[model samples]
Target: MNKIELLELLHQEVVPALGCTEPVAVALSTATAAELVGGAIEKIEIIVNPSIYKNGMAVGIPGFKHVGLNYAAALGALLSNPKDKLQLFNKITDEISKKTIELIEKKLVIVTIDRSKEVLYIEAIIKTTEGTARCIIKNSHDNIFLIEKNGVLLSEQKELTILDNQLYKRLSDLKIEEIVRIIDSCTEEELLFMYDGVLMNTALADFGLSEQNKDGLGIAHSLKKLTKNDVLGDTLFSRIMVKVASASESRMSGCPYSAMSSAGSGNHGLTTIIPVVEFAKYMESEKIKLLRALAIAHTLNVYIKQFSGKLSATCGCGVAAATSASSAMVYLMNGSTNQMGKTIINMIANLTGMICDGGKIGCALKLATASNAAVMSAYLAYSDIVIPSSNGICASTPEDTVKNLGRVSKLGMQTTDKVILDIMLEKVMNNN
Candidate 1:
C-alpha cells in the first residue's frame, strides 16, 4: 500500500471514541441533526439497523449512568456538538442529563429498526420549532453520507465509489513481509503519529488501574489480586493481560474517557495495542521497533476486519484484534513473516468462534483471555509449533485463512447472530 493510502486509512478508522462505537455513532448523528435544526430539539427519532440497535441498546454512553441508545441520542441533542465525533458526551452537563432523561421519559426520544439492509447504519432526525433535521450514517460507524434540513437536501449523496473499495482492499492485499518492510522504512512523521496509539491507549489502561476500586467493578484490582502467575504464569504475562483487561474493563463499564479505537472499535484497539505496548515496555525495546510493531498490528487488524465486516456474530477482539497482536508479538521477538503468519494462523484457529455477546463490562474477561492466548500462540509459532492447514478451518496461507475465518463469521454464523439478538431483545421485552 502507498504511504498516502495507509495514512488516510489510519485517519479514517483509528480515532478516539468515548464509549462503544454503536451508541457513540448514534450520539454523533443525533447531535449533528440537532445542531442542523438550529433550535431547541423537541423530539429525537433514531432509526438503526438491527445490529446497531442490538449493540447500542445496552452499552453505556460516557459520563452517564444510563446504558442504552436512547440516552445517547437524547444527550446528543442536548449537547449539540457533532464535531466531537465519538467523544460526543464530553460536553454533557447535569442539566443536559436531566433534560435528556425528561425527553426519554416523555417518549420524545425514539429508537426503531431501520428495516433497511444496512448492517452498520444510524439515522437521526430531530424535530424543533423551526423544522426537522436529519443525518444518516451507513457502512462505517462515522461515515455520515446524508444530511437534510426542513425537508431539503443539504449535501449531495455520492454513491460509494471504486476508490473506496480499493482503500478497503489496500491493506488486505499486502503480504505480511511487505507490511513489515514498509513499517521498517516508515517515515519519522508516520512513526510519531503511530506512537500516539500507545500513549492514548496506555492512558486508558493507566486510569483504569488507578480507579479500579473506586467506580468500576475493579477488573484491574481483581486481576492484580489473582496471585500473579497462577492464572497466566509469571509477572510479564500478568502485566500484559491485566493492563489490556483493565482498559477494557474501564471502557466497557463507562469510565467517561475516550479510547483511540482501531477498525472502529475502542475495545478492539485496546485489545490489539495494550498487550503489544506493554510487552515492548517490559522488554525495553527500541522506539522504532515498538512503532513498527504497532503499525503491523493495526494493519493486520484492519485487513482481517475487511473480511469479517464491521460487526459480526464472531468477536473481532478474539479473532482479528488478537490475531494482529499475536503477529506483532512475533515481530517484536525478531521472528519472520512466516513466523508471524504461523502466529496468525495459530491464534485464529483457536479464537475463530468466540461470540460477541455485547459491549459491556464482561468483555474485559474475553479481551484478557484473548491477549493471554495471543502470547501463547506467538510463542508456539516462534518455536515452529503450528496448527497445520489440514487442521479444522486452518488454510495454507494467512490471507486465505483469514478469509475462511471471515466466512465463518459473516456467512456461517448468520443464525447465531440472529438468535443472539432475539434472545437479547426478548429479555428486554420480558423485563418490561
Candidate 2:
C-alpha cells in the first residue's frame, strides 16, 4: 500500500468498539443472523473457530455477570445493532438482562464447533419463530459475510479473508524506518482527524468514572483523589494516569461506553493513546503537537499490530502501546529520528511478550505498568541509552529487534497460548 492507502488501512483496522472485540463480534454475528430470521430467536447456535474461542474465553460483557461465548451470543441476540458495527452489543441494557436470563434458563444457546473450516471463523445460526438464518465473520472480528435466511440467501461473497491473510506478509516486510516516516510526516489535516478517537475514548473513560461499577478498578477515583490533593506537582500525572488507567479498567470490566478501538480491540486503542495524551498534557504542550503525537501513537500501534495479527498468544497492547509512547515521548522532547528509533528498540526489549488472558480489571494493572515502562524507555532513549544487539531478542538495529519480538509472539508463543487457553477452559468447565 502507498502512504495514503496505508494510513487509511490503519484507520479502518483501528476503529471504535464497545467491550471486548471477541464477544462483541459474537453479538454482531448473532444480531446479523437474527435480523435475517426476523423474529424472536427460539434457539441460538454459535460455532467458533479455535482462535475465536481462545480470544473469547476470558472477556467480560458489561451488565452480564459472565464471560464466554454463550452469554455473548445471548446478549447479541437480545440487544445488538447490525448497523452499529463495532458497537455491536451496545444495545445491551438492564431491561434486557431479565429476558436474557430467561433465555439462558431455557437452554436456548448452543455453542458448537465449525468442523469443516480453518481455525479462524465464526458461524452463528439463529432459529427464530419464523425460520432459521445464519451469519459468519471471517479473518478479523466484525468482518461479516454470508448472511442467510430460511432457504433464501440474504447476502453472499466473503471479500476480505483472502486479502487479509496477505496483510501479515505485507506487515512483516515493512521497515521500522518506513513506519516512522509515515507517522512523523503525516499532514496536520490527517493527524487532526484522529480527534474522533480521542473524543470517543475520553467519553468512555468519563462514563466509567461516573458509573462507579463495583467490578471496576476505580481508576477515576484514584485520579480524583490525586487532583484533590493540595499539591500541583502530582496533579497532572494523577489526572492523566487516572484518565488512561480508568478507561482500561472500565473497558476490561465491560463498560458500556464505546472504545475507539485499534486492531479489533478497544483496550488496544486506550492503551496506546492515553499514555501519550497524559504525557503531552503534563508538559503543557501545544494542541497541534499533542494531536500529531496522538496520531503517531495510535497509528504506530496499528502498524505493529499488523505484524502481530489481530489476536495473538502475546499481548499486543504491551508492545503496541509501549512503542507508541516511545515515539510520542521522542516527539515531545524534540528528539531526532535516531532517538525515536532507539526508543522503539528500548520499548520492544523491555515490554515484549506480556500475556493477554482476557479483558478485565487486571488488564488495567498491566496497562499501568506498561505505561510506566513506556515513559522509562522513552526517557532512556532520549538520554542515549538503548539495549545492544548482543542482548537476548535484541538485534543490530531497532527494526530487527521488533521483527524478532514479532517472531516470538506469533511463532514462539504458540504452546504458551495453548496452555493458557487450556487452563482457562478447565476453570470454566470445572466451575459447576
| Full-model lDDT for every candidate | 0.84, 0.74
TM-score of each: 0.96, 0.88
What lDDT score is found at residue 374 in candidate 2? 79
Q: Pick the candidate with the highest TM-score.
A: 1
Q: Per-candidate RMSD vs. true structure?
A: 1.7, 3.2
Q: Which stretches of candidate 1 lie over 4 Å from their true place?
A: 161-164, 211-213, 228-234
lDDT assessment of candidate 1: 0.84
Write one digit per residue (lDDT tens) for candidate 1, span 1-432: 877777677777777888889888898898888888887778888888878887787776777888888888988888889898888778888899899889888999888876455468788989998799999988788888899999999984677722267887677788878877877777766767777778888998888888443656777778877745476455767888888888888887778778888888999899888889877877688888888888888878888988887888888999999889999988999998999999999998999879987787888888989998999999999998889999999998888899899889989998898888888889888987
The best candidate by lDDT is 1
Residues 1-432, candidate 2, lDDT per residue (tens digit)? 446765666666668887788888888898888776678779998998655776677777866777778888888877746887767665677877777788788999988755344435788988888889889888778778778888688777756553355554555466656665666677767767677887888887777677555557565566566666664236544565667777887887776777887767777788777777777767787877887777667666766665555667777778876687667878887777677778888888888768866555677767767777777788898998989988888887766777787788878877787787677778878986
Q: How close is candidate 2 to the true structure, as a TM-score?
A: 0.88
User: Model 2: runs farther than 4 Å from truth?
Assistant: 63-66, 93-95, 113-120, 151-172, 207-213, 218-240
Residue pairs in candidate 2 whose N, alpha carbon or C atoms collide under 3 angstroms = none
- lDDT at position 90, candidate 1: 88
